[model samples]
Structures are given as C-alpha cells and as structure tokens.
Target: MRILDRNIIKYKFSFLLSCLLLLSGEAFSEQQRVSLRWKPSQGAESYLIELSEDRDFLRVHHFYKTKNFRYEFNSQDSKFYVRVVGINADGGRGVSSPIISLADKFAAAPKVKVERPSTVVASSEELRISLGDPKTSGPSSNTPGSPNSQKQVPVSTYYRVNGGEWQRYDGSISLSQEGWNEVEFYSEDILGNKETPKKTKYLKDTTAPQVRLIGEKKGQSGLIEIKSGAELTLQVTEEGSGMEEITINLAARDGSGAEVNLTLSGEEAKQPIKISSSGIDGLSILRWEANDKAGNYIQSELPLLIDAKHPLCVFAPTEGKLREDGIYYLKENGLIAIRCEDPGTGSGLSKLEYKIGNGSIQSYQNPIGFNTGIHTVTVYTSDRVGNKAELKIKVNAIKPDWQKTGSELQEK
Candidate 1:
C-alpha cells in the first residue's frame, strides 16, 4: 500500500510540469535568427512547438519537438501562430499556451546626425547630434493592438572614442577636450544583428578672433579725431572659422554713449570703414569688437578728444580805423560785421559775446552799432570744445556835427 501511494504522488508532481508557461519572443531581420522562450516545466521531460496561421492548428506550417523550454526560428519564417505544450515522462499532459504571432518583430536601425563648432569662445561643450528614422510604405508583423507610429528602441547600444575600446552606452555622452574628436557608434536588434558602425570627426575650438584697428592711429596721447557719421573699419583675422558680427561704441568721458552695429556684407568685408563722429565732441572713447562664426569674440578701444580748433574773431570794422592804430573809430550809425569761424572740432562754433564800452555783456547776433564818444568794445568767441578767444578795440561814434576824425570828437 505504501509503495503504491508514493508512486501516485510522483505521478501527480510530474503531471504538473506540463503546465509550463510561454514567456518572451524576439525576432530580427530576415537574415538573422528568431528566439522564443518559455518557463521551465517542473518535472517535464520535453516540449512541443508548432507554427501555424490559426489557433486550432488547422493550417500548421512547421512543427518542433525539443527537450528544452525554448525554441528558435531561422530567417525563413515570416510569421507564426506559435504555441508550446509541456509533456512528462509519466505520460502526463499539463497546460498549453495560447496562440501567438512571431511576425513583424524587427525594426530598422536608428539614424544619427552630428554637428560640431570650431570656435574657441561661446561654443557648446558636447558633441551635438540629432536622431532620425525613415518612413517607407510596407507591411510588418508587429502586435495587432499596438500603435503603428511607435518608434524603435535598440536592444543594445555601444560607442568608441578616439579609436579606443568600445563601451556600452547607458545614456548620452559628451566631448571634454578641444580640437578634433573621433567617435563611433551602433545599436543591435532583438535578434542581435548590429547596425552598421558609424564613424566621424568633430572639430571643437575656443579661441577669440584677432582684431586690429585699420585707420591711421598715431598720437602720443592715443588721440583720435573723428568726423560725424564716420565709419571706422578694422582688420580682423580668424582661425578655424569665419566672421559673424562687429560692434562699435562711442561714449563721453562721463560714461554717456551710443552703440553702432556694423554691416558685414556688400564689400569684401576687408575694406576700410568710415567712423562717424558727427555731433560728438570733447573727451570720449572709441570702442570696437569682432566676433567669429563659432561665437568667439574680442574687443579693443582707445581714448578720443574733440578739438575742432579755436574760433577766430576778426575785428576789421570799416567804420573807423587808423591803418597803423589797428583800432576802430566809428560814427553813431556805423555798422560792424563780425565773422567767427572754426575748422577743427567737428563740433561747430557756438556762442559769440561782446560788450560796448562799460555796458553789460550781450550775445552778438548781426553787425554792431557803436555808441558815441570813444566807446571801447570787447568781442569774445567760443568753439564747441569750450575754447574762447577775445579781442578788444577802441572806437568813437561822434554826432554828425562833432566832426569826429582826429578833430574834436576824439574818435581815437
């Protein structure tokens, strides 16, 4: 009785092994192998696999018998209605898996694009790259319930730097050093078919552009004379990249300023530029900057002083003057035309003031009319830079009856 009971328990345990479960399935391209795996049966001796077009095996295409819990297909099988059945040595049958399709399980490889900048300044530190996938009109064997627009994910990924050993890539990576950096990368499909390895070189630079002032810049005080609306061009040299932008700034000694944006097209870009100093005067600054295509940039500046030259006051009054006295003697109704001129400061001459004898100072407008009896006049002129010049002369405006020459009216 005891022996019979032990044999019954053994048979029950063996029967349970037939309830093995079908697990995962993987497929690659038509040139690669496909894999199907299942959970191990507890005490089963072997397993049976079938590929078909229907769940009931009505249109079975292939049959497989093996001792292990897994099976594999070659490049020949396009699709499968696959299932696995467990069997035990005691002639027991356990569970059977539901129907499955091993069709359209592979995807195309991922495409990659890389961008590299070779400027020494304001450039990215990483090796810039973008990913892409092509679209084609075709048929596939993916899951029926899944979306058709899903992207592909690599089963495995790897990379190499500077012809070094290949390493598994967990995520993204970067290039730390400047200059040329060589890289290689690829990924694998579910069936372990690796995509073609891609190789390329990336250029990295971090140097600023070289800048030099182009015009005649010669003076002990670094002095410069700028005309209004003048464009000052500078010679710029760049390595590893082309030019991008240029900027100029003019400001007063008190930090007041205006900025100028320069055009980089039209001419060869090497031609001289006119610097505009119109309406600018006194102590100021001339600053310039240059930028390279890769974002590298540099700046240069110098001190500027405005000196349009002093205004000249010509006291050539026609009313009265001894050719040798260099002084004017005028009648009460006589007129004196005043001329003030400045050729130096870019800034025009501003104020002109004069006084008649002991009268209050008056801003000069047109010609002057003299007062009677040996009047003294002082003329003052100022330029844009605050330069002032004064000339004094003695004049006498006598009444018509006074006869004011060297006679009695004292016209001096």
Candidate 2:
C-alpha cells in the first residue's frame, strides 16, 4: 500500500510539472515579432493602430495606415498589446480598440526627408526646381539615386517690380531692368512637403547713360546768326554712350500754308553744319532737331530772319471815257497831267513809263503831253525805296468854238 501511494504521488507531481511546462511554452511562444501589419478594413478605409500594456489602456500607441498595411515597431519594449480602430473618411470614429498584440505583427515606417536649392538669385533662369521628397534636404534629389527617389518637384517663382505686381517668372528667364527687384521662390516635394517659407533677394543697378543738351533746352527759341557759308552749331552730350547725330530742318510756311521741309546736310551732335544763304532766298524760319543712340530726341527752333526784299508794283488808276474831239483837243494841248503817288516808303515818283491802250511804252521825264481824242493812258512810276506807282488819265483836248467867236465879236 505504501508503494502504491508513492507511485500515485509521483504521477500527480509529473502531471503538474507537465502542465507548468505547457504554460511556460505558451508564454515563450508569445514573443512578439517586433513588426506590425493589418488587413485593410472594408471600403479601403484607413485603420488606426494603438498599443498599450494594461487592458485598462493607460498609454495608447497611435498610428495611421494609409495605403500601406505593414508597420515596424521600433520600441524596445518586449511585450505590448495592440488594438485597431476603424477610421472613416470624415474623421469619424466607428469602432473602439479591438486588442491585438505585437506577438504576430510585421514592419515599421521608414525615415523621410526633403531637398532644396542652395541659393536663389534674382537673375536665376530656372523655371522649376525640385525640393527633395520626404527623404533628403537641399537639391540632393537633383542627383541620381537620392532620397528624392521620385521625379523633381515642380517649382514656381514670382517677382515684384519696385514693390508692384507679383509677376511669375519661368526657368531660363533673365533680368533686364535694374532696380530693387525682389524675387520669391516656392517649392513642394512629392510627399506634399511645401517649402516652409518663400526665399527672397534684392537686385540693384547703378549704371545708365546720362543725357543732357550742352547748349540749350528743348524748344528753345533765339536768333541764330550763321555766316553765309558757316556752320550752325548744336551741342549735345551723353555721359555713357555719347551723342550719335543731330538733325536740322529749315521750317517755313509753304505756298499752300503747310510746314515745308528743308533738311540741312552734315548734322551731327557736337559738330557744326556749314550752311550758306548766298543763293537761298525767302527762308522764313530755321530749326534744329536732335536724336541720340537710345532714340531720345531734343528739338529747338532757330528764329532767323533773312533779308530778301524785291520791288513791287503798288498802284494804277481805273476809270474815264471821253469823246474823240476831246481826245484830239487834249493832244493839241501841250500839257498832259494826271495824279500819281507811291504807297510804299511814300517817296516821290521818279521816271515814268507811259502807254495808251496797246501802244508802245514810252519813257517820260516828269510832265507829259496828251492829245484830244479819248485816251486811256497808263503810267508806271518808282520811288527811291524800289516801290512802284502807276497812273491812268483821260484829258479834255477840244475847246469850245463859241468862246473863240465871242472874243471875235467883242473886238468888232
């Protein structure tokens, strides 16, 4: 009986030891894989992952699953109970945490960075620059095999002109104007990482041609006395590029009352234009116009009066008809007279040229004789000032025969 009791006790002890070993084996098998994964929920909605130690949820490990289903947990903790909750598109929560232990999960999230350009200048000609993806920083992605694994990110740059409108500039554009121009650059990574802030730079230019008229202002008017064969002078200066050429025009009122053109030859800035008036007559006004290499223009009018006067005919009489006998009697009478005067310069009438109705012009000294017949006599006279006068006359040539008879009767 004693032997039997000892055997039963040993058997019980063995069974108890076996049950403890089984429990130990199950505990050892529960060692977590250190990785994590999950089957996406219905409708491809994202799932929220959480980790905690006590079932009461003292500390929660939160993770967002996008298109990816696997995540690696890097925490050194040996044992951690994980749970997943369904997340809706509207940020609404559907289910509370359903416990899942890391004992069987696989995978973890990798580190990501971004890249960008070193220096952004106002004169840079790049249209789009790639900031790195969520991997490397600073233009490293422009190289091959970089963390910026994807194609370059499209970048847009804008500029302000003197604090004015924001103008977009493409890659390969160059700055033309010089001023306090400001440029701002923007870039976005493939991973949706936008440049934290825009970059800016200022440009300055202190070089440009200085232009001025050396002798006169634009639209200046004054007497311009140039020798008959001398050149007219115009002084123009440009500090940087210097003056190119000059132009002058003899502007005058034409016969049709329009501004007529007369171009002067050999006109250059800072140079003289030799002009002569010996053969030129009746020029009313002269003017100078100038231009520079930059296409800027300056103009001045020369108020020059040229002396060119000529003799002019001023007067001639208009009336009178007489009988043939009266014309005959005037021809018989010696004294022939008519009133005459000079209008211009009012000088006395000098030598005269007389003609009667298609007759030859006859030169006469002062007094002239006329016949009796009805005569249409015309005379042209001149004064000392080269002005001319004209006169026409009808003279009575016949005397009454009754006057002769009455004298004869008185003698009888």
Among the numbered candidates, top TM-score falls to: 1
Clash counts for all predictions = 23, 37
State the lDDT of candidate 2 residue by residue for 1-412, as single tens digits. Answer: 0011112122101111000000011112331123333334444345454556566678753333332333333222225566555556676654443454443332232222212212211111111222212222323234456566565654444444344565654322234443334444444444554454454333322222232223322211233322222233434444422343455555332422223343432234445343444433223456665433222334566554332222333221122234455442343335554445433223234556788777898876555554545557777765432445566655554433434433344553
State the lDDT of candidate 1 residue by residue for 316-363, as single tens digits.
566555446765667557777778887643345778999987789999
Residue 206 CA error for candidate 2 (Å)? 15
Q: Report how far off residue 115 is in candidate 2 (Å).
A: 38
RMSD per candidate (Å) reads 26.6, 35.8
TM-score to true structure, per model: 0.37, 0.25
lDDT of 2 at 94: 48
Candidate models: Cα lDDT each? 0.53, 0.38
Candidate 1 worst ten-residue window by lDDT: 1-10
